[model samples]
Target chain A: MPHATRIAFVGTPNCGKTTIFNTLTGLRQKVGNFPGVTVAPAVGRVTGTNTEAIDLPGIYSFAPKSPDEQLTVGVLSGMEQTIPRPDGIAFIIDGTNIEKGLFLFSYFAELGLPSIVVVTMIDEIKACGSTLDDIELEHILGVPVIPVVGNKGSGIEDVRLKLTDIKEFAVPNKLAEPEADIPARYTSVRNIAANVVASPVRDRRTEFLDKIFLHPIAGPTVFLAVMALFFQSIFTWATPLMDGIDSMFSLAQDGINTVVPDGIARSFLAKGIVAGVGSVLVFLPQILILNVFIVILEDCGYLARAAFLVDRAMGLFGLQGRSFIPLLGSFACAIPGIMSARIIPSEKDRMITMLIAPLMTCSARLPVYALLISAFIAPIYIGGFFSLQAMVLAGLYIAATLVGLLIALLLKKTMFRGAQTPFLIEFPPYRKPSLKNIAVSAWGRSREFLINAGTIILTLSVILWVLAEFPRANIPAEMQPLQAAQTQLEYSFAGRIGHTLQPAFAPIGFDWKMTVGVIGSFAAREVFVAVMGQLYAADVSENDVTLREALGANISLASALAVLAFYVFALQCISTIAVLRRETNSWKWPAFAFVYTFVLAYSASFAAYHITLFLGG
Target chain B: MNINELAVGKNALIERYRSNTVFSERLMELGLTPGTRITLVRRAPFSGPIEIAYGHLRLALRPAEGDGIYILPV
Candidate 1:
């Protein structure tokens, strides 16, 4: 068998390192159009070839200040046991910023490995009225210099063919020790850069956009406008798709009812299996829609500017600018939000961001809030433009965001009090986002959500179905169908448990039925609405009737508000807990998050119920 | 004067950092060493991070770190 060769692509952030790696290996590593997209190394083999490529996270130098940087350092230094040292290194250099790239490569030279320099974004350099002589650069750096426009796939064949005989490439001469001082090495890098690069001009396009996007007052206004559009698109665009999925599920349920006998087996098949699958599939549209916007914004480099605008506000919450992206993403779903927190360099800041993410009131909690608000709050028009009910909904969103920030502040003060990590970010020049890359990234994120969270939601649905189905009670033959369902659930395990636990939640104005819904929602936040619909025999599907009216006739305004308050703060989604466990590599932090949020939810609900009662609710 | 005091769009030569911390080391590693020509591009609103250019690289530095790097007007 021919020996397989592994090559590592390394470079500073925003240097198009991942782009070249993706081109060579044919693997789309999460849209390498922006910094922090490739926070972890992605390994893939060259299609139909024996060569493999490893795309490491971008780093400025061998000195590691962040976890991702440490991973790159560990792998390159042969200290990481899992990732074997590569046979060769592809030192990716940015054509526009060769000086900075060479400064890092000076450190790479000390590794003494067979190396090749692949210069990316050559077109960007030319467009900026600069010229780079790759032949001259090769002569000065003493390695093969291949200039490639990565996004256009030009010069990639040269890279692939070069990798076949990479072992024969001559190692660049080492000019300094591994621990050499930076300023001295940079002097040598400056001399080398002076030879190959001519008439370097600042990127005029980026500078022009920055004037408006980064203007003190205009910058924040543009950001807020963008955010409003982003969030509005999620609900406006996703509603039709969500409604389609809802009807499809209802049709399947009707099919089951007509085909199967009216008995326990039919109930299990229809309510347990079909409903479980439907619940999982219903969330796909919202997830896909949310990811589409995130991918575009990140690719265009606007997200970095948004972070810059919000850095001061985030500082008051003890988080740096990097934490804002993850938190903004949390409003869609905490799973993606938690995963995006990988971009944060500091471990403490990352953890704090992840811990408070659930409090942002993810889309999963939207149904619960909607059901409660529609039931209790009257849709009275205020000022002829705003509806009181809609205002209440907006108030809930604002409250959740404020509470999330406060929690971050509290965690910083008590648990993570220490010297602050430095906040340094590079401003990559804006480029038109690639449609294909954006599509692939959004699809990848949606697929990940389906696979990781889908199984847990499916399993929990079946478990809750069982808890509501067993220990069926005998109803009088003349009793109505709704009465029979109520009787069966009241006698079932979930019902009995709810009745037993009612006294504990009584202070928060929860009755036994609401208690059951709360317990069921621990599986997934939207399950509360489903459980309530089933218990009342009221259809909660799109354009369906009676659920809202039934709930309104039964519960008071105080209890409804208390329930809404509880949903705002509770960390009830098991998928989020599972993601937290995976991200932190331990159960301790997830357990802490769950316990503290639960305590906070209970206290907040108690306060809301009594305060409303005292106000003559 | 330090970087925080440098006017936007003005040029200067960087001097030694006031403190020998990791933050300063990282800035120097990014080629912000003494004797390098630097330009204060802009500062974020609310006295947030400041953007500076040296050679071909543009970096955003928090005020806390930017305050430590002294510069000589040129």
Candidate 2:
């Protein structure tokens, strides 16, 4: 009958706050937006205890620059009516950087919340010949100061036990006020650090690494090379897994056909549900692979350096260096990327980043790109190291980035123009990435993709099947079976809609079938392939020979390129629009995003079709 | 002298902040108040933000904002 005891985890960025939260909560964390805002605050219950921990966004001070920071302050001060006041505070601080940590600690202490300090990165501190005396810190701060290695899970149990007794901890009534004369605040922080930390050595390892990683020229080159390898692996490594999934689904379809009679139910089970969902599900392997890489890069502390390296280039487009992390994250999927935009300190910058994030070639686009490129571009070695197909794949990615940058520039100059805030980012110390964290992250993201498959994609696939299958046209007396099927599709609902829209798409070389594919993909971009497969009566498996041959025989290279160009610009995914609406907290931005992208897709595809035709393709 | 004019590896004492805004207030909250000693850690290439370090904190400030922070050589 008692309300859950709420514990808040607060810290500056890169202080291993989330790592500790994950260690304590394990799989119990629930991600949801704070009341009335799209910034997600993860709340999780401490294992085997009645305490719930709210993981607040990382911030430097109570002064908020963005909606995310404002939410944190709002929740802490009980200003937001929706979030309850916390019963206790579990303040996380980096052990190696005690002064900054102490400053934040002092600031939060002023709120007079019963709090405990968990000094993380104890291993890194020990490696640097520094020692933190938690007992001495406890005496000075009048709260428990527990030294912990968050990533390794060392000393986590102690922190958990301390949380159980947090209600009994005395709240500091006269702690140092951070807003007092700034020098006095610094002096107080220094006095506390001196009392608890002993014989600290400068972190030379970080310096040496930064010298190479932050070097202007070398940094960008290494970044480019890493990206090159990243895209290459997405293509090469995912093929076998994708093919395996394709065969498994096809075999399932075969099993269904033999067991069930040839009826509408059988058709729905095999073609509508199996093939349609399977088509989208096959991209799961590539999405997982990309997420794993991103998680590792983020966990290892390289992503911040990457942001630092590219700040200037991004600055030219009026984007902060902080925008780099979210935009790069969009390459895997825009949902997480848009969620990560909370880290950007400026509101306008975060909005601009989210608007352009979908322009980054997401993994969903990879399936469509690969399909088009393999069907059109020959597999000849371009320069011994690269295949022509690989070049086109890379080119699609580059084109997406260029288009995103240009649009960001235009938005900044017009709709979102304001004073650009200076960039201020913390470069966290490099440490070995925890495999457990990476595994949890990858699994979490993969599960999200599968859930999307089961819900929205499933519903849309069934509807598409009905639209393509029902109201069969009577075969003409002299027509062959193939022509009869085509006629039936032309008369169906989806087919009718496609036919009505075909004239508009005709200049871009799309037939009614391609138009239907485009219409079906409004559910998600990957559905285009499944819809096309159904239209052609070919097995909707990856690399289906019948589908490829049929498509290649009927479609010109110019039309194939037009389709590729269309997807690169089109905001076709309904889920993306939903998230955009939710994140922006209004339909205005999402509507703008959808309309502009649709216009861009149509005009670009039209131009691409004509240009390629003119070039003799 | 302004923060942007400080050479890399040079240390300075923060004197006063020129711009009065929410962002400048945030910079002060991050311990960039007057009399704090700060060093020019590095300048990002292509006239990008300048990295400044003060008492275990490193922050990047664009030239425009950095120009608003007046400092005296330490």
Candidate 3:
């Protein structure tokens, strides 16, 4: 090849193809979308080599069920425009499932391109007292068969050497005909396995684990426990890291305060740049922790089992099992949750999941909910265990969750109504997950989140800061600092716009000040607390009793509950909208999500406020 | 009988697919062609997907997909 040779790595899902790709690329990979498609595949350069490796989405056969599978086939067959056809193909096969691997390889061999077969998960096979004869297999298939432990880096150099030397790869002339029956291909694969695979033993350990993990009762129980652990780990473990990030930004603001005089530059530095970036990065810890669990669960082969366990319940709402994890992840943060939807092979299920993800009461909404509930709801003990305020907070979460699922069901019935896609998942034998692989995968996801969503958040923060800062009004010299600050805010552009929107927001019980708080929160959900504190000119925090009492004195219980209802359904976070746009590769879905959610928030809050007034609250 | 009708731990040989379509063809390409031996491993709780082992590979398929596979008890 005159130019740098591009080698495509193809394999079935859960065949360790990603592990091999990561091992070969070594943190040099970049994800880019295919031309005319939203499916983003990772492309990386082979370490110390000029060859480039493209990690295609894993598939079982060439059958194109989903858009991703169709894109994979398009790229492989050279029908795709932007991604030029690769000079060679690298077929990564799981050693434990040689027959299935070889079956797909037979099709790859027909591509008439020089190709090499790399057998992964050899260690798993060896632990079962079985071994693969790569040489004999190579002789039978008329190709090079290199067996390697992908995660452990065994035999990787040989594969890399072969990759660089594409001319040496065996280009099969004939095997199965284009229209050959499935039996014909399998017969050849079976005959080849007979000669090369010795002592093919069943993995008893996997069977034993399945007995508990897949048990009728134990299965669902364990799945619930695992999910609980997933949320607990991300929330409880990520707090300290998130707090560290939060304080680091505040310290930077303090330093800027001392050095930079009180002016536009100082405010820009402290609020627009520092606080904006901090708000975005504060989520990094939770994203990292969330990705770690996903990678571990997926790598260890339990994610499929998790899917299987939840398929029936998800099916009730027009989704399948795979939608559960993404929706579950949304409870932590919708950015990572929407990103995780890439794993759902079915387009319908993925879209429904992504659209409703923001309504799942993410961690960002916690402070706002805490503030509102504390402001209005009484803290009287309920049954000597649950406080009334705590119960109301939980009720808001439950209400949002139900509304999200209800919308999903409605979408499935209206927008995506049609024949359901088949759910066929391969259950790879359980193997010990690699920490290196988990770290690498998590790092990649976190990086993607920061880069793709971070820019939008930063821009929104600056704009909000400008809107709140401009059109300054002079304060009387004898006025208090807080009062002067409040007066300045009331004269700002955002405050004027809030006054303009008073008529529109009046039905939902929002005064001009509350409307300003709502507008400020569009940057992020938690910013509502800070905005309300600023509007009232108190050093506002979720735990500050001063701001709580101020809100209690000014805002009626009806308006407070209406605000809570509005937050529960609103897609206020721009980061979620950005991620949705990135994932869907179209403005249509994200735009629709924003419109639908705003309507929901408006109607729900209207009902809440009027109903409370009717009940004389 | 269909593969879904087979008892857990019972071995069966694939008779044929109930129909010829992309869905069934995909199953056939997964090494489930006629005359192959498969054993029902287990079923997920609350009538979820079913797991089956053929050769060294295990596959989880929803019952609707499983219904498309005809089987003969061995």
Worst 10 residues of 3 chain A by lDDT: A537-546
Error of 1 at B14 (Å): 1.1
lDDT of 1 at A242: 74
Residues A5-79, candidate 1, lDDT per residue (tens digit)? 888889987787766765566543442222223234667676656777788888888889776788788889998
Tens digits of lDDT, candidate 1, B1-74: 78898999999999889999877888887888789999999988778988887776777879888778898999
How high is the lDDT of residue A248 in model 3? 89
Angstrom error at residue A161, model 3: 3.3
- Backbone clash pairs for candidate 3 read none
| Winner of 2 and 3 under DockQ | 3
Question: In model 2, what are the clashing residue pairs, if there are any?
Answer: none
TM-score ranking, high to low = 2, 3, 1
* Cα RMSD for predicted model 3: 3.9
lDDT of 3 by residue, A1-617 (tens): 56888999988877889898988898889886566555778999999888999998887777776666776888999998888888888988889888888888778877888888899988887888888888888877788889999778899999999987788688864557787767998898888787787866778999999888988888889987886576556545776886798678778967997999987898777766776666557667877887788788888889878888878877888888778778877876798688767777677888899999998888677667756776787878879865676567667777998889899999999998877768777787888888778888888877865773366556666676787778878879898766766677778897899999899999999998899878877767766755564455322322324556788988988999889999999999877887788788888988999899999999999999999999998
State, as a TM-score between 0 and 1, how close model 2 is to the true structure: 0.94
The sequence of per-residue lDDT tens digits that candidate 2 reaches over residues A392-507 is 88888899899999999999999998987768777677889887778767777767777877888788888888898778777677986456666777778888898899998998
TM per candidate: 0.88, 0.94, 0.88
**Clashes found in each candidate (C-alpha, N, C closer than 3 A):** 0, 0, 0
